[model samples]
Structures are given as structure tokens and as C-alpha cells.
Target chain A: MSSHPLDTALKLAPSASAAGHYTGQSSPAYWNMVGPFGGTTAATLLEAVLRHPDLLGEPLSLTVNYAGAVSAGEFEVQAQPVRTNRSTQHWVITQLQKDADGQPVVCTTATAVTAARRETWSVSDAPMPQVPPPEEVPRLDLARAVEWINRYEMRPVAGVIPQQWDGSGDSSLSQLWMRDQPPRPLDFCALAAMADIFFPRVWLRRATRVPAGTVSITTYFHVGLAELAATGPGYLLGQARAQEFRNGFFDQTAQLWNQAGQLLVSTHQVVYFKE
Target chain B: MSSHPLDTALKLAPSASAAGHYTGQSSPAYWNMVGPFGGTTAATLLEAVLRHPDLLGEPLSLTVNYAGAVSAGEFEVQAQPVRTNRSTQHWVITQLQKDADGQPVVCTTATAVTAARRETWSVSDAPMPQVPPPEEVPRLDLARAVEWINRYEMRPVAGVIPQQWDGSGDSSLSQLWMRDQPPRPLDFCALAAMADIFFPRVWLRRATRVPAGTVSITTYFHVGLAELAATGPGYLLGQARAQEFRNGFFDQTAQLWNQAGQLLVSTHQVVYFKE
Candidate 1:
């Protein structure tokens, strides 16, 4: 598949970076070899793209098929303009990581079905969720190296961030004010990472402390809408439902809506339990 | 990883069968090499799982990752009992197919999360979408000779079936009386396949002449309760929202609910298109 000149050129291009520290790029430890699942890696890569200005304003559908087991490695976003449209652009973004062969492993080659931003007729007229603002909500730092979470500065509007070893059970539902540290413009990829983080908040809504469940989430991104720039105190309401929790695995569904009350993105996760 | 003595035995057990007449295999046409965006074959495999009796109670969350680009051969699923509760059973299903070694490819595994039927608790409900009775809807026999749709019978309430292919781009909503020709216990797997088929019906609703849409559906399966059995007429309501569509890919959410108004299952799908 890589036997073309463009492929060679694409391979040699420098990696894209968001440059602005607004979007936090968390520590490397969390992304390497810790979890065997591909979802974590995909989420991490999405952040990398979100920070990179070159990849902004594009809609991407990242279908990360767990291609066997992937090893611990660093990844970069390599997107190139193949065609541009008045309203849309077709481009490719590849997750580049060195395979065991010392050769690069294209963890994923996604075709971003991007388009030029259009004036949305949506007024986002709905009121924010009837919850306390972040200034009122207590802030608690997690013990884990905030690799991905580091990019987005999150202030809980309701509860504290649970530690990895925290035995205290918390409600599955959570409200928070999330913003890039430097206030960078968020892209489609960033919205995905935001949606992915909501399931934990939902878990907090239920119990005081929960046995962190392992669930596989598959997201189908439809439209490209930036959330970081949405009007308001700049927070998206995220709510999750512990839909089913039987067997050793449970499923959770989460939805993210901007301040104006339009559904921005939704996510579904299936988790494995420890107990 | 095969640590238990029963591991090998579990691996050898034949996968449970659904309602289809053919039990052991699927056509190679839906192979990824045939098309990275190939979806119908996967749809058929899903159909077989739906009809398989042993898989009846087991819940399904099938995510066709990477548009399933490389189909070396049929990826088959076989189940193993993990745990059983008074209310629900826990089953983990392993999908088997050949790897590049011509050896078995270790496809992703999914565990069914089902809750046991319980006494009445706090109740919240959503009314079933209103539509014509199943007997009033038209039929579409879009089954392939070697494929799977023929395994069951569908009676659409508002429009014609795909087999008829009467071109009409009207609405993307329809109701149906769907059941196996030889009736079987309605279960989670069946509901999954129903969600799969009903998705196309949404497009069918808009078909004034022929269904005109090419798509790759992304779906999220909700925990299903066998709530439909009590319906006197036993007809099912399948509804879909063309949630969002842009840049050639669109997403629609679908569900299968019984006549009693009990919600059976919820599904979300993202389909890609050009033609």
C-alpha cells in the first residue's frame, strides 16, 4: 500500500504540533504499554492532532481497528491535503509509530471527511445544565500523570477527580469546566477526547467510589464542530448513563452538549470489572 | 494466554447458531479485499448471530472497525460461560478467523451485559413511536440466495421492501412485523440484527423509486430486555433518526421496540456515502 511517491513524501514530512500550550499534552507514561486496549492510544493521538494547527478545522472519522497487539511507542499526526472543497476537504491522517521492524507502523490511516466551516443556523439557545459552576465546585488533582488530561485544564463543577487507587466511591455523573490551558481553538479530534472522558464522570454520579471498569468505546464522528470556541464560561455538559452492568462487563453511554444546549458529540463504552 | 485446561476445549466448541438455515459459514464476497467499506457481509454475519439460538439471550455490541478492510475469511463467534446471576447470565464470545499466518486471527471479544428481570422499581418510560400496523405495511424481499435476509420475514407498515425496489425518496421511517418464518425465541442477538436491517429502512423511507444511498453504519447496541413477547400482535416498531450527515458520511440512531411499548434495544449507526 505504501509503494507510491506521495506515500514517500508523506512519510518524510515533519509531524504536526498544536504549538500553543493551551491544549495539554499529558505525560508519556500513561500512553505506553500500560493498557492493552487500543482506545486509550486512539484518544491520546486525537489530542496530538487537536493541538496541531495544521490539522485544525477538519472532520475526521478515526476507525482504529485493533491490529493485533500494539507495542508501547510515541505517535504523531501526519495529515496531507489531497483535495479541498468549497465546503469540504478530503485528507488523510496517519498514526505513525515505529513497529518492531524498526520500520514505521501506520497504526491507522484515516480519511478525514472534512469541510469548510459553514454558518450553523443553530442558536444554541438552551440554558446550561442546572448545575453549579466550576468556581463553586471543588477541585481535586488526580495522582496519575495527566498525559491526556494535561492538555485540557478541567475544573470539576461538582466533585473531585478520583485517584487511581482511590477507594472512595463517587457518583457516576460529573459536571466540569474544561478548557485548553492556553485557550486554543478545539477541533473535531479534541471533541472526541472530551466525549471519551465523560463516562468516568457518569460513574461518579452513581457511587462514592467505583471499581474503574474497562469498556471498549467505538465512536462514529458525524460533523466537525469546535467546542473550545463555543460561547459561555466555556464548558460542555457531559452526562453518562450506566446503561447495563451485568456480566463482568458493563456498558455506558455519554453525551456532550455545548452551553447553548445542542448535542455536540456522543460516546458509548463497554467496560470490564475487577470484582 | 491459554492457561486453563478447558481453554482448548472452549476454543473447539462450535459457535452457536441463529435462525438461518445455513449454520457453519459465510460467503467471501463481503471480504475486506472486496471493499474496505464493505458492510453487507458483516451485516449477514450479524444476521446469522441474531438467528443463532444459543446466542439468543447474549447481548451484542458489534463494532466493525476500520471498515473491516481485510477479510481473510469468515470471522466466527463462539461463546463461553463466564458467570451467571439469578437475574442475568454473563457470556464472553470470542471471534475466530485466520491471521496472516493462515492461523486463527484473534478478533476482539465482547461480553454480554444483561440484567436479570427484577421486581418493579423506579419506572421511567418513553412511548413507542406511532406507525401503521405491520399487516398494513408492504414487504421487501431483498434477500440474497446464499445470503441471510431470507432467513426471516419482514412486513413493512408504510412502504415497499427492497426486493420490490420501487423507487421512492419519501421519508426515512417505517414500521414492520418482523419474525422468523419458523418462529424462535426473541433475544438480544435477534434485536441486534433487527437494528442492522432497520437502519436501511430509514433510507428506504426516502426511496421513492429505489433506495439511493451508499453507507457504512456505525452502531451502538443498548442492553435489551425480552419485553416484546407480551404483545398480542407481536409486531415491532423500528425507528431511526438521520442524526447528522455531512462530508459524504451520515449517522442515524435506530431501535427495536415491541408493540407493548416496552423498549427492546437502542442502536446508533454512522453510514458513509457517495452515490
Candidate 2:
């Protein structure tokens, strides 16, 4: 077994006869205050589709919904390709586990689209923000209250966690340089988890650490395997911000760029918050 | 039967026996060059859930994936609430239509979350762009080649459909004031359709009218039904821009605000483009 915590966390064993069903376990290495880190869960779902025998091409888009809280233990994941076109494929994935009554319950639901990409007219209209390189920026050592926070090394460029939770925060923008703590190779699964690496926008926007969790997150992958492989284990520049917060909910959008300035993934998430 | 095009397009009749199944027909009033307008299709799926007897609260987030080209004529939708909590519910929806072989095939898949929202600490960090009021801006008369273009009234504030196709355009930002024509009151369904009002960013960015369509879209509702109802039948300020375009796929983020500058809806979409 690989020693990487992420690898162990994402390990899945295929069902004996079922084509698309696999069982996996939650990793304590990536545990959050409530449950497993959502990023890791999202990555694990994508991992299932990537490992599926019927997968058509590289992943282009993924949307995952946290239907309910997942309990620690073994869980079953179903990644079935519902539609397969000449150049694209669509998949619906579900993560289910048993409840106290031993009845199977869904904890997460997701949809992903993979496509055989072709070279096209490409442009980077949203330029990488000019910022200090990761080497120059000092690494932020957040209080390791959450186990997941210790898995990634983050260099905060701005919008660090509020020192004074006095609700004086005026902006929700946060920019940071982040990568796996042990520096694993950059891949789809790693990128997916990294997309959700930033702290919840609500916490930063209000500077009030109220209860918050991601309800739904959608990520669009701009590059394919070749581009990602070329990136290796480099640090990714991540920037996130919230547009509006109202009625106990807010949405945040984020972008991740490689050190070479290639935009890798763009993600948007809606989060439930309690004031 | 309702005479309003939107109402007609969204009309659904419950299945005789199935709890979450409904049957509906496509309307020519909202037809595009290829198939029915995607936005209307998305709203129709949401409508099924809203009309479902087991529905819990107003919509908070919706993610729709266009799995295949939906054929015209009768289509069936299934909106199943997978999990319902005290304050939130998670739903999975699918749209299917009979293929040429008379076999039902999936065309679109969607997931939605509805919640009973409570008053909370709210703020609009992303302010609505200042622009001329709808009364001050003249309505744009698009060459109505596509039938759906005539369904709404649009006034371009910036980045109108490019006048030249010579690839001289530099940016992919579009700001406009738009609303349903014949003046219909704004609702979740109307807001859902309007979220996709902007032209694909590729056309405006490269000034090359390439074939493009949205593959997946996710919309987050920051306000509840009461806030939407208060807006009445007024023009919404809509602005959209693409952050990155690469390898035949690009993502765009948009925001819709009421006339009062209250952010009503925020949406993100990934589009497939051909060179």
C-alpha cells in the first residue's frame, strides 16, 4: 500500500460482480470537524470514474452534492456512465453507506463529463494575478485543530484566517499558494481536492467562524492529462471569493493556476452557513 | 393552457402513478437552432421538483448537465428527493426522451437543493455594476434567427454581439439588462432561464462565430422566493465574463441582480467550443 495519505484515503475495491460499484473507507488523515474533508470526497468520487473501465476520455467537468453527513466506516460508490457519445461521456455517481438501522443511505451524489479534447483556439483572458512566488512567501502554519488542514502546505498571499473573529472582515477574497504536504504528483484527483483547499468564504467574509459547510460544488477542468502531467508537483495559485451572502447561504468561485501560469481548474461552490 | 410562452414551456402534468415522474412537451416558442433552449430545459426540470408533493423548501442551488441533444416532442422528467432534512432537501432529476428506436434515453441530468432559509448576517461583496437603468437604455433588436431570441427583451450595456467576425475582439465581458418579454413577474423558473441569457463568450472573445454550447451549468440562488417576488416585473442587470478559454472548453461566470442592486442569482457554466 502506498504511504501517501491521499492514496490510502482514495483506495477502492471493486465489487465482486458489479461493474460500477466499489467500496471505500473514509480516511482519518483527512477528517474535518464534521466529517471527511469535502475536497478528498470529491476527489475520491472522481477517482472512481477515472478507474471505471467504460470511461471515455479525460474529465472535463464534475459536480458533487453533499446530500447528507457521511459516517465514518466503509462506503459504497457507484460510478456509472449514463451517456456515451462519440467524443464525450456523462456519468452519475453516488456514495452510499449504512445507517443505524442498516439501511443503505446516500451521502453524496455527483455528475461528471469527460471528453476527448481537441486542440482549438485557446486564450487566457484572465491573467494570473501578479504575486510573490511560493518560495518568497512564508508558509502559514494554521492551528492544526482540523486534521485535513495539516495535509497541505499553504502559503497565504492574502486573506488569511481572521485573528480577531469580531465580524470586521470586509472582503471575501483569498489568494494562496498550496500543494500536497509530501508533494504528490499533480493529477485530476489531486487537482479536484486542491480546488476546495481554500477556507469557506463565509468565515473570511464575516471574520465570524460560524458553522459552515459546502452544500454543492462544481469544477471544470480546463486541461487534460498531458498538461497536468507536465505540471508535476508544482504549487498551484488559488484565489477564491464570495459574491453574495444571504438567507443562510453564499456561493464562492475559485480558480487554480500552475506555476507555469496555466489555468488548470475553475470551481464554484454553494455553502450553507449559520449566523 | 397558459398563453405566456414561459408558462407554456414549463407546464408539466404529473405521471398517473409514479410519485416523482412527470411528462411534458417542448414548445417551439423557446426553440433554438438545434433543440429547445437549454435554459428553458433546465427550468423545466426545476419546475418538476418545485411541483413535487414532497418538496420541502425553496431552491438554493441547481446543477444541470446536458448529457445529449434532446429530441423535440414529449419528454419525461424524474425528480426524486433522495434525502430530506429538517431544513434542506436534496433532489436528483433526469430528463429522458424516446430515441428513434423507441427506447427511452437520458438527455439531461440535474441535482438541486432546497432549503428553508433563515435571516442571517448578509452582505453583497460583489456589487452590481453601475449601468444605465433599463428605461434609459434602448432595447436591442437582435436578428431573430433563433426563435428563443425573441422571447426576451435585451439592452446591451457593453460587449454586444460582435459586429465583426475577423478575430479582432479582445475581451469576453458582457453586461446587459434583460427580462422576459411581454413583462412577466420574476420567479425562480424565470430567473433560472435568464441566467443563460448571455451569448457564449467565445463569440465575443475571438470575434469568431464558432459552434458553441453549454455542457454543464450550476446556478446558486442567494435570495429566496419572497425576495424574487418583491422584484415584480423589472429588468435584471446581468453581467458575464470568461476567465479562461483553452483546449475547446471555456468557463463563464455570471451574476444577475434586481433593479435594486440586490444579487438574485449567480451562475457558472462550461461550454464546448469547436474550432
Candidate 3:
């Protein structure tokens, strides 16, 4: 069996001297217009913490801050388990690369919480939006300009990407069914990346493709490891929309539901846009 | 005129020795059942960054992780500007206090982005929910068990706090009109605090007030400083609801709109709950 591109992209090696330091390289397969896809970077950061020796349990929440763009080369990640309680653990992570002058550059910063989940009274207030099954929807056949777009099989249901950039767009909402191209089993790391797979809301709301990138993203995992394992490699229903866009900034809120209509993760991101 | 209690609670004194370190004390006016209100803590952290000499612009987004419960006493906050771009600045902040053995303890970790906002193409997709105006609604008169409740006057319209703990709550949605008791002008700090001024959804969903508290919260400010100044001290509309509650955690998303029905901020949080 060959290693999946995602697995190869996320592979990390621990430093012998430092406890929390690990080194990894950016993959050309996940390259975006500017840098590696933000979702891939987010997944790599969470993977660093998930592989920590002192990890408590599954991830409950993860926040990734893209302080600066990552260069295509080797980078070091420091994932420190700052605090650990009986049932929960807190981690602080940083991705750093050396500049031309040999000074350390901060590419990203993140915080994650891991907890030992226990069964309790569970309820889902927001049910999955009614949409056609993935089998009925046709696969999206857009021109994959960015390399990262080829890694996912997307079936857009509503609010599809505007075909013409004529500045006549009205809605920012997008609902779709998506899964890994090679059908990898769902896990915390993959789920974190999938949470950010949607296009920028500004691009969807307006016909013009203004320059926009996410500044920060936060994802809350709604289920434990068992639920994710049960989900297998099935497609997830994703829906995202922007509430307001003003002053060169807008926020997008998104949700992912499993094939069984179980809410898996809900993520929010604020993007910086230029007029 | 004397200073408003909200301002008094957020007062910070910069340390002469450290560049980005400040000292502050918890205020009795905003005390919760366990510690000082989380909203006040968030506001204080943001205020520290806003007060920095090298501060660039207004806050665009903020994420605060409650690593541990804060005690009622003096705490030190370290707010560092880790990265600075042409129109945006990234900040990392931490709150610390001495433990029983006089060692520093981490209570909270946060990341914020401040941007020099410029005029841009904007839109409001999610309009304010239709409801009675603040003038027509009666002021809510619930018992003030927590001291923080007395600081804000809330007029709930729908999905108000449960009248009985019979687990009859079929909806976790809550809509209300709220303002500071002394009517402090709306600003980034006040708006950040107001974004979190909602009860835990678990308690609202079920009659039994099982122990619940916020673990992490991220707020995205959609408007600029000028709009907040224009809002003045008028009441703002707030709506919040739980998307799902499973295992030992649940996530809540909320929005705040001014009296003119302009969306100001949208916030999200994950809470830890006991069965």
C-alpha cells in the first residue's frame, strides 16, 4: 500500500533534544495560489498536538491564527501541553521558519483543547438542512486551478460558485457534499481541515473575485473518536454563509454533518479582504 | 461625573519594567458565581492590546481560551504584538496569577488581530430578526443571583430563561435587548464583553442547571470604530442558540445588532457541561 498524499503532507518528525518540537515540510500537492492551503496548515498544526505524548483525549476545540504566510520549505512546530486537568488538557502551538537573515519567523499560532468525552444527555438543536443525498447529486466539475482543489470530491447542491464575475451575485450561502478524493477515514485532523474547505464568502456573495484570505479560524468538534470512526469515509454535508461584510472584513460560519445527519463540527472564520 | 463600573472593572495599569505587561484587579461589580465574569476578562485582555503604544488599528477578531478558572484577585496580563503587516497586526496575550506556591499559573490564552479598516463594498445578508422594539419590551426582572446580572438590563423576547426545571425546553434560541445599567457608550471593549453576555445554553435547554461554563470563545467584529461610536449607549439586540450538545460539551453562536438593525459582531463558543 502507498501512503496517501495527506498522510505524506502531515508526517512530522520529533526533535531528539526538544520535547515538543517537530519538523515538517510543505507539500506541493496541497499548494494554493499563495501558499499551502490554510486547511492543510490547520490540519498540520492540530496533528502536531494530536500526536503529543501527553495528549488527554480527542480534540474538543481548535483555534488557528494565520499570522503570516508559510513559505514552501521546512518549518518547525512547537506544541506545548500548557495545562492538564483530570479530564481536559490545553495546548499552545506555534509554526516557525527561519528568514533569509536566519531570524525566526512566526507563520502561525494555535490553541487546542482535548478532553475525555463521556456519554451524557445529547441533543442537536440545529438539524441538518434538508438536501439531496450525495448519490443523487452530480460531482462538481469546476476547473481545478489550485492544486488543493483536486484533493476533494465536491458535489455542490445550492449556492454554487458564480459562473460569471459580473458583480450581480446576491447570496453568500453554499451547501455541498464533500469527501476526500481517495476516501480516507474521518479523523480529528481530517475533520479540522474539512471545516475550512469552503470558498471565501465575499467571492460567493459578489460576482467580482476580490482578494481575500482567512485571518483566523475556530472549530468545535461535536463528537468523539468513536463517532468519527463510525462515520468511516462517508461524505459530509457542509453549509456556510456570511452574516455581514463591512470595513474590509467579514466572518463565515460553517457546519459539517455526517452521512447519518449527526453534527460533527462547526467552524467560524474571519477573512481580510481588499476592495 | 464618576467613572462607570464597567470602566472601573476594566481598568489596567501598565508595568513600567515590561513593554506589554499590565496589572489589573477583579472587580466586585462584575463577579460571577465562581469568578469575575468571562466577558470582563475578555474585554480586559483586548483593552490591554488596544492600550499598547504600538497598536495599529481597531480589533478585527479575538479568540480567548479559558484554560482554567480565574480566582478573584490581582492578575498580570502579557499582550505581545507577534506579527505586523501593512494593514493588519497579530497579537498573542496571556493572563497569569501566582499559585499557592507562588508560581505563575496560566488562566487564559488569546490571539487577536487589529486591522486598519478601509471603506469597501459591503452587504448585510442576515438581517436582524423581526421582534418588538426595545422600547416596547418590558425590562426583565429575574433574581440577580450572580453579581454580573445586575450590571446589564436585559429584556428577553423569546426563549427566555426556563420558568421551571422540568426539562421542557424545546428550543435553545434566545433573543433579547440589552444595555449596560449605567448606559456606557458602545466601543470595542464594551462590545466584546456584550458579545458573551448570554447564559449557558445547557441551562436554557434543560430545566436542570447542570454545571456549565465556557471553555473557549471567538468574536469577530464586523463594523469599525466609527460605527461603534455612532451607536453610542443605545441598546443592542442579541440572539444566541446552541447548535448541538453532545458528550460533555456544546457550542453556541450569537450575533449583536445595533438599534438601527446593523450587524456589529458575531461570536462563537464551546462550553463544558456536566451530565
Local accuracy by lDDT, each model: 0.44, 0.92, 0.92
Per-candidate DockQ vs. reference? 0.09, 0.86, 0.85
Q: What is the DockQ of candidate 3?
A: 0.85
Sorting all predicted structures by lDDT, with the top scorer first, yields: 2, 3, 1
TM-score of 2: 0.99
Tens-place lDDT digits, model 2, residues B165-244? 99898999999999998789899999999998889999999999999999999999988878888898988999999988
- Runs in model 2 lying further than 4 Å from the true structure: none
The residue-level lDDT of candidate 2 at B273 comes to 92
Candidate 3: list runs displaced more than 4 Å: none
lDDT tens digits by residue: candidate 3, A157-226: 9988889999888899999999988899998888999999999999989978989999999999999878
lDDT comparing candidate 1 with the true structure? 0.44
Q: Candidate 3, after superposition: displacement of residue A62 in Å?
A: 0.8
Better of 1 and 2 by lDDT: 2
B144: Cα error in model 3, Å: 4.2
What fraction of the reference interface contacts is present in each model, in order? 0.07, 0.82, 0.80
DockQ-sorted candidate list, best first: 2, 3, 1
Model 2: per-residue lDDT, tens digit, A1-275?
A: 55889998999999875898999999899999878999999999999999999989899999999988777889999999999998899999999999989999999999999999999889998788999999999998877569998999999999998989998998999999999988998999999999998888989988899899999999999998888888998999999999989979999999999999999999999999997
iRMS for model 3? 0.8
Where is model 2 chain A poorest over a 10-residue stretch in terms of lDDT?
A140-149
